[model samples]
Target: MTRQSISITAPNDHWLKAQVENEEYASKSEVVNDLIRKARAQQDEIEWIRAKLIKAEQSGFTDESPAEILTAFKEEARRNGDL
Candidate 1:
């Protein structure tokens, strides 16, 4: 795989190195990779939630009982095998 060099300042570098040591990351690159993956996962979740909300709004969904809403969500999740 191709790699690129990134410059970090002292405190940020120190924090990253400390995290690497404390978390037992194999190297700084591993820590950075994990961070990137975690951030991407978070972004994906946000985007999914936003899309769901927009669809719900567009569908004119009304306020419903928490249990009913949850049941619908669980059914959808199970249908998609994502629960």
Candidate 2:
């Protein structure tokens, strides 16, 4: 575990205090760590989505009919045990 001293301003300081006072966090460090964790997770999701979009763009369009698409979707759901 690492300990560091950092400064925060007015409303942000109040927010941290409120989080600890409200028992949302055991300490201000917990709040900061949680925020960083959430931010990193969101960034990861954004990167995943970007990669998917690029892959789809590179894969080009499909010519399958709407009914065929629906059938394939249902088959996939069944295969995945989602149906």
Candidate 3:
């Protein structure tokens, strides 16, 4: 494992200390690493949604009603195990 030397604000440092005291994490390093992992995952999800939106936009306007479109989307999500 690589060692890091970084500074954090008082509030952020306090939060990390609290996490360790609460036994939610083994150490500040673990808390920071878990947060980084979550942030990376969130970014990936955002990129995926952005790609999907771009594809939809490029497909042009649709004649489907809002409700119909939502239902279809939900059905597709279920089929893909996304919902």
Instruction: Look at candidate 1 and tell me the lDDT of residue 56.
Output: 69
Instruction: Please report the candidate that would top TM-score against the real structure.
Output: 3
- Please state the error at residue 41 of candidate 2 in Å: 0.3
Model 3 C-alpha lDDT per residue in residues 1-83, reported as the tens digit of each score: 99999999999999999999999999999999999998998678657756655566567777555456556766886799765
* Highest lDDT model number: 3
Q: Is candidate 2 or candidate 3 better by TM-score?
A: 3
Q: Is candidate 1 or candidate 2 better by lDDT?
A: 2
* Model 2 stretches astray by more than 4 angstroms: 62-83
Give the Å error, residue 73, model 3: 10
Tell me the number of clashing residue pairs for each predicted model: 0, 0, 0
Candidate 1 local accuracy as lDDT? 0.76
Note the residue pairs that clash in candidate 2.
Answer: none
Count of clashing pairs, candidate 1: 0
| TM-scores of all candidate predictions against the true structure | 0.68, 0.70, 0.72
Model 2 RMSD in Å is: 8.3
- Give the alpha-carbon lDDT of every model: 0.76, 0.76, 0.80
| lDDT by residue (tens digit), candidate 1, 1-83 | 66979998999899889987897797898888888998998678657756666576567676654455556766886799765
